[model samples]
Target: MFTGIIEETGTVTGVIRHADLWRISVAGPAVSADAAPGDSIAVDGVCVTVTAPPHDGVFIFDVSAETWRRTTMEEWRAGTRVNLERAVTPATRLGGHLVQGHVDARGSLTDRRESGAAAELTFCFPEKFRKYLAQKGAVAVDGVSLTVAKLTRDTFSVAVIPHTLGLTTLAEKKPGEPVNLEFDVIAKYTESLLQFRGTGERELSEDYFSERGF
Candidate 1:
């Protein structure tokens, strides 16, 4: 679990091809400070295991083919900036919404508008993901937690503050650029529980006791 708070803007140091997998190395100081082997790190919104512990704040990530297929990491180049975040701890402050370091899918940026002190970025709403999105909902794009400022049939916009622009890779995104997107996990869990409630072949209900074959 994570808070969707970006700790560092890590640079992609290496990209190695092994079969269909990619061994990536990212350089992040804050996140890699207490890093150890097998630790979880969110790189560009995807949770990757630490194959190599931090060496001078650099961490190595081992990514699978399916993970790359679901995210924009496959387009990463040397020096590409990515959002780096460590898992949330009990003592850590919840600065942002809950993020699971899981990318649901990739979306393309379609428009950008400037507000008084912020910028509103609109991205095309993926057909399958539309059901999960709504105005004022939480959405993690490329690992940055943002609120949906507005929603349309085919697009959703998010307001980006100055800090977000400077601290995360969202600043580098341009129109038509692809970004990794993760919907609020709570939404998925809630929908699952609601949809499957009492719909099983063997219906279970509070009105019927266990012995009554409810």
Candidate 2:
């Protein structure tokens, strides 16, 4: 799991295509410091396994075809700046919301406006993901955990402070650019548990509804 706290922005140095996998090399000193083969690294919110040990502050990863279909990594090329985060450890401070580096979907930037030292960015995502959104809820966009400042029928917005803008790729994002999104995992789990309370095939329906007078 990750904390959605970007350690630093990394630059893509190489991308080599294979039959069913692509080998990507990224240069990040902090992220590669203790990284080893098979370690988990969140690259723009998608958990990718490190395929090779870090070499001169650069680490390599193998991206499978399925991962390509699920994330924006397919669009990555040399010189692309990506948010980087290492897997959280027990002793690590939870600086940001819990992030699994499992992207739920991709969204596009719809609008951007300045708010003094901060900037508000509006995004439009898949309608099916609307259930996971709520005002003041946490959302990870491109691996940066942010709070939902506003919500609409098909859109949501987050306020990005100047520090966040400077440390991550979010500042370079333009309208219509794709961004990977990971909804709060706790909310999804809550929704799943609530389903067992309703009239479904689940065994807890009878006992669950009786206590709540459903």
Query: What Cα-based lDDT does every candidate model obtain?
Result: 0.87, 0.92
Best by lDDT: 2
Query: For candidate 1, lDDT tens digit of each residue in 1-214?
Result: 8888898899999999999889999989998999999899899889989987689888998888899888998899999999999988899998889999888989989988777667889998577778888789999998888999898877889999988888988777899899998998988988887777748644446754556765
**Which whole-number lDDT from 0 to 100 does residue 213 have in model 2?**
92
Compute the lDDT for candidate 2: 0.92
Clashing residue pairs, backbone N/CA/C < 3 A, model 1:
203-214
- In model 1, which regions exceed 4 Å deviation? 201-214
Tell how far residue 51 is off in model 2, in angstroms.
1.2
- Can you give the TM-score per candidate against the true fold? 0.91, 0.91
Candidate 2 wrong stretches, greater than 4 Å: 197-214
Q: On residues 112-136, what C-alpha lDDT tens digit does candidate 2 reach at each position?
A: 9987877999999999999998999
Residue-pair clash count for candidate 1: 1
